[model samples]
Target chain A: MNLYYRGYLLGDVRRFPHWSEPSDAAGAEDAALADETIVYLRDDFSVVRSPVGADQGVLWDAMTPQWREFCDTVLRFRPPRESADGPA
Target chain B: MDRPDLGEQERGQAVGLPYIVQGGGENLADRLAEDRAAIRDRLRTDGAVLLRGFDVGGTDGFAEAVRALSGELLPYEERSSPRETIKGRVYSSTEYPPHEEIFFHNENSYQQSWPMTLYFHCVQPPAAHGATPLVDTRRVLAAIDPAVVQEFSRRRWMVVRNFHPDFGLPWQQVFGVADRAEVLKLCGDRDIDAEWRSPDQLRTTSIRDAVHVHPDTGEPVWFNHIAVFHMSTLSADLRDGLRELFPEPDLPANSYYGDGGVIPDDVLAHVRDCYRSAATRFDYRRDDVLVIDNMLTAHGREPFSPPRRVAVAMAEPTDAGARP
Candidate 1:
């Protein structure tokens, strides 16, 4: 299976900030050039984008060390996810 | 310190200390009225009242008794709004020296609504000074000019809640109504405006120019644009500018009216003089519970020696607009 690690950029994401499926490679390229490009890592972990998106979870899992470091460095105050027991 | 005088003790609680009722089989209404006639009358006529001897005895006993009584009268949620201290939910007067010449006004007057009744139980009354002076707003209204009353009734007034940094994040976020939409919704057809601003190191949201009438009596009240606009603590410039605009109708310093604005200076001076002239002094004895109508009367304490303790509980209307 050919996997394309694609994501959104900071600027483009601002217009449509809510979570959504990734656009095609051409659109991603346009967003990249527009400076709205976020970081995107391929299946092999080579390509890097300028901005990041929520859809990069799969790419993040593949590069555990880099992903952990990036999260610790950038997103300092992310709240813990709710447990299966549900909200209090 | 004088030994507990048995003679004074047997005469009921000594002067200036809280006393407890073991269990008096009296109808609540009758008891409230009979024991607190001065306060009730003040409430009916003035919109506020105070009883001095409601709480007396040892500090712990007074606090516990008040807490229990308050729990019965008010719900848990309502009780949460009270100021807490090491002694109890209600801060004792002993912690802070009472302000002398404390002017007449409602408690938390800046809010959209305020407590309908306020009760102060005297744990210890000052040996000298510390007499709670009372005033009735109805008398004030009756005393003022009919033309002035008519004009105020017709006009909408403004209220601005200046945000204070001391409120911290949680308080700042949830200080007033839940949100702007809530305020608009609650205001309904009333002609009003609101602005959120940062002033004096506090983020504040001010509601401008709203009209309100007394819910029960349907009396045309001057609700709006007094404490928040003209009070010295809020904005001196706004108050001064307002005075300049309505020079003849300037609000008096250190005083407020039920109409939700500053009582006019001339009227204020007259009322102040009347209060001063009619002032009466009394001391507190233990086991007395004094209740007053929050809206009908204004209350103030005379200065006193330290270690004076008092517990307070405020009663409010179940209906949102009935009292504030």
Candidate 2:
């Protein structure tokens, strides 16, 4: 299944990636190492952990530290259920 | 298609053929009768019929041919865009792409008085891609519910005109109205109505529902959104969203709002599904002319590679009046 940013429709996402290196690197000497360390996401998400073929740009941009922090906070503070049985 | 009743004098005579030599023609009366009879039958049953070998002499001969057969000058104002001077509208698939699906609709549906008959001549055929598709509005209308038909007859529809100003040419200039009163004046006060937004733009006004009954045959016709509202271009976002909401609406990209605006989400979804499940398509070939009752049928183009060229001629009976 595909994931959406906010409440966007599934088809709206052009690309998605899995993992990546830190956004900032020390100097020019570490540029090559940073590039190699990054992991990308695939559109189909079949190989979620493989990082064999994923969109590098999407992984780097959409999944920034800020976005991750947002996701973390939302997960930690879940809203109370309206009903015990669940919404009708 | 055989008629043994044709007399010997009419056997070899060309009835609808415009370029056929007439000086030594066998019996003009019999040939004319045959031609008229054929046209009448086609109109009554199929809503349209073709006059094969009507005239192939040459493009220059087209005007003369039309004058002799219909006893009227071709409307110079109705020529296709860019070449208004040309006497006939050209339709060719080789020049245009098939991606632009023309909506199924009656010709001049927006006009107060539409032509009674329309004729097309194919000058060239596409290599593999273009085909003209048409749907009998009458057939569609006959199959729907009566309440739906009543709903349409009660409303005033809108058509937004967005064509560029000064487009028609020296013979005729493109003009638009802004309100129902002006629309009535432009259309000669036929029951058909419109509302203009700008000098060169307008909207459909006073439209019937998606289903209506033909005044002549009393046969129910599916003369609704598929023909009138569906012949326009819309934004990709709105189009996709509407399609998603109404997965089966079969909404083509062209259909849009009366103000030339995006249709509302809920309304779009509702109409899209209704059309998707009920509409049928037929392919048209080069030189294959289809005669249809403007009130009973809706015509649309299937998207093809450009430049799509199709020539059309409209014929109105002497007494039909200018009311579509």
In order, the Cα lDDT scores of the candidates are 0.37, 0.37
DockQ of each: 0.00, 0.01
Where is model 2 more than 4 Å wrong at Cα? A1-88, B1-33, B51-55, B60-85, B88-98, B145-147, B162-172, B176-215, B224-286, B306-308, B317-324
Docking class of 1: incorrect
**What local lDDT does model 2 show for residue A13?**
20
Q: Any runs in candidate 1 off by more than 4 Å, and if so which?
A: A1-88, B1-89, B93-100, B164-200, B203-281, B318-324
Model 2 lDDT per residue over B6-39, tens place: 2321322211111111212223223334465545
What does candidate 2's lDDT look like per residue over A1-88, in tens digits? Answer: 1110111111112112333434332235544332112121232221121111132223234545554543333211111111222111
For candidate 1, lDDT tens digit of each residue in B219-318?
4332333432334532355457646743322232222343456556654343343333212223444443444454444455555555565566555543
